[model samples]
Target: MAEGALFEFLCRMGDNTLVLGHRVSEWCGHAPVLEEDIALANTALDLIGQTQMWLGLAGEVEGKGRSADDLAMLRDAWDFRNVLLAEQPNGDFGQTMMRQFLFDAWHVEMLAALTRSSDARIAAIAAKAVKEAAYHVERSGDTVIGLGDGTTESHRRMQAALDLLWPYVGEMFLPDAVDAAMAEAGVAPDPASLRPAFDARIGAVMAAATLTIPEDDFAHKGGKSGFRHSEHLGHMLTEMQWLQRAYPGASW
Candidate 1:
């Protein structure tokens, strides 16, 4: 496969974790319970750790001499290749877990596929990330069930979250040129192939949660393409990139 294609694929992987990690980090100290606060913090840390490996490899593949931090903290929104799902705002605690559950379901499958990547580095990174992702899906699924099947208000909010976030889920399985290259090279599975497993996983969890997925079949696109992004990304970039932008060469 072309090196450019590999770099694009890596960016997609790294950017997913990076953006979602930041969103989850926002829950620190704001979760409804102390345990959840800690859990969210750890989840964010796990994702950021995976970000280091993924973007680190991405930078190496690009051979631009950019570090992972540069790719993560210096890039503009239009340059990011994360799916639109990962960038959605964490509306409420229920919404946050719903988003996490949805993404985690997709993520677990993605990482599992990557662990078998033809590229050794990709395989290694996925092996480590898949472990954390397993836990992420489990915890998020439980939270989804707890909130979705709990009190009437919790159930209502959880259902609302599912309705709002479901459209974003389709983007995870949407294939683009970059995804095609990755799959053809055996560096990743065809994005579409992962859909069946992802569906089965989420279906069981949502059933347990008693949450009905939206039947819209309509998905928001553009984030992975880097041709378009939601307004939320630009705003997020301002805060996420500010420190690095303010101090160009500074580092810890």
Candidate 2:
């Protein structure tokens, strides 16, 4: 039971990184500016690297015949455990930045806490990932501030972007049964515990961006804890899983 719980937790982490990384990778050539394009691509590469580590750890923990590649490429859309925020369509440049800003802030806090996990391998992975995530958060926050406080059009677009993505943001804080069990075992941090820190960081960024937080009283939820995802995820999985599905046991 412990191992099963651990595997589930690890898969959740891996899937989140993998899906978000792929989403970000979509901007590799299409960013509004050249410098921003490079920045987004770099962030995507970092996330992809993080996914490799987490998925490899998950494979080891599962002690199954399945490898990281098999798990990542063979999984269906419904089988993915990433939050809806990560899989949401990249609406515009501002929209992408808003999504990244929210996700990176939460990710930084989660990785920092996970660095102290009781599980040695998990701790090591978190320790390494925390550095990467910290930079990602900083860069994303800077972009949000830049665009939000820039020209009138930029400001309006950024505000709209924030509103569109806010509904999905709640899922990052939603705790699941696996999370609860891991918290009890000192293998994971409570999602709720990270909220204050995440809020503070996000607030600071919004302030710097000269933007107001959305006043939506009712926040949408349920994506990571097994709720259905946006329509985008199905298309993403179809492309991502095609190779493995088409050529069973195919290898490099």
Q: Which candidate number has the best lDDT?
A: 1
Worst lDDT window (10 residues) for model 2?
217-226
Against the true structure, whose TM-score is highest?
Answer: 1
All candidates' lDDT scores?
Answer: 0.93, 0.87
How well does candidate 2 score on lDDT at residue 8?
A: 80
Model 1 lDDT per residue over 139-197, tens place = 99999999888999999999999999998988999998988888888999998999999
**Residue-level error in angstroms, candidate 1, position 181:** 1.0
Off by over 4 Å in 2: none
lDDT of 2: 0.87
> Can you list the residue pairs that collide in candidate 2?
none
lDDT of 2 by residue, 1-252 (tens): 379888888888898899999989988889988998999899999998999999898888888777788789987877777888888888888888899999999999999999999999999999999999999988889999999999999999998888788877777887878889999999999898999999899889889888888787455655575567778889888877787788987878
Residue 109 lDDT, candidate 1, scale 0-100: 94
Q: Model 2 misses residue 37 by how many Å?
A: 1.8
Quote the lDDT for 26 in model 2: 89
Error of 1 at 126 (Å): 0.4
